[model samples]
Target: DQQVKQNSPSLSVQEGRISILNCDYTNSMFDYFLWYKKYPAEGPTFLISISSIKDKNEDGRFTVFLNKSAKHLSLHIVPSQPGDSAVYFCAALRGANSKLTFGKGITLSVRP
Candidate 1:
């Protein structure tokens, strides 16, 4: 079974709007959640992260929220910019291991 799921494969938003990317995981062992953003022809780079103990974490225009009970997590980008358009992946790690399990990336398009 797929441990992580991104129900929506893609999301589009106009510039200066809020963009929300969501993910759900079935494994209860996931303790640390991360979000990665990837540009065309580039490797995915870490964007933001939220630990299972915290409900939310914010950095600049990006924020990540985790609802452990629901096995859901979301990334919010405020005033979405065209430059922010990319394939975003939700990842989870258990017990400080180097390996991370990732969900299918969700392509995000920002229209100017």
Candidate 2:
């Protein structure tokens, strides 16, 4: 059905702690994965991505791990900050088109 699912709508974390966000996909044809961070009203920005050939990818404070066998993935943010508080969307690409199928969105709140 090409559905990307983010079961949790929101998450909260304290400053300097680790924040974990999870996602799942039902489409076996998907080969690429991405995570985007968004602020209010604006489009999501590419954060990190993992290809089906790899199990994990990292970018500075953000890391994404993919488990193709289970069709699951997660994003991790370490030393979370107040500025990190924003909505995160999990997306997937089926082919070379580079277009993305998004989850409903998850709001991350980092308390100071």
Candidate 3:
């Protein structure tokens, strides 16, 4: 079974609108959660992250919320822009090794 899951295969949003992506995890030991945006030919770039100790974390237009009790997390983008279109991956890290476990990723298209 996959430890991390992104149920949505894709998401489409108009420019200046809001986009929401969801992620769920089965591992309770996961303490660090992160969101990464990847383009067609490049590697994923870090977006936002939240630690299990915090309920929410935000940076500019991106925000990440973590619910430890529910083993769920969500990423929200406000005023989505065309450049924001990419594949978003949810990742989790735990313990000293800090190995990352990533979700399947969701393709996001922001229309102008």
TM-score of each: 0.97, 0.95, 0.97
lDDT of 2 by residue, 19-59 (tens): 99999999878888899999998989999999889999999
TM-score: model 3 vs. ground truth: 0.97
RMSD of each: 0.8, 1.1, 0.7
Clashing pairs in 1: none
Off by over 4 Å in 3: none
> How many residue pairs clash in each candidate at the backbone level?
0, 0, 0
Q: What value of lDDT does candidate 3 attain over all alpha carbons?
A: 0.95
- For model 1, the run of ten residues with the poorest summed lDDT: 91-100
What's the candidate order when arranged by decreasing lDDT?
3, 1, 2
What's the CA error at residue 110 for candidate 2, in Å? 0.2
Query: What range of 10 consecutive residues in model 3 has the weakest lDDT sum?
Result: 91-100
Q: What are the lDDT figures for the candidates, one per model?
A: 0.94, 0.93, 0.95
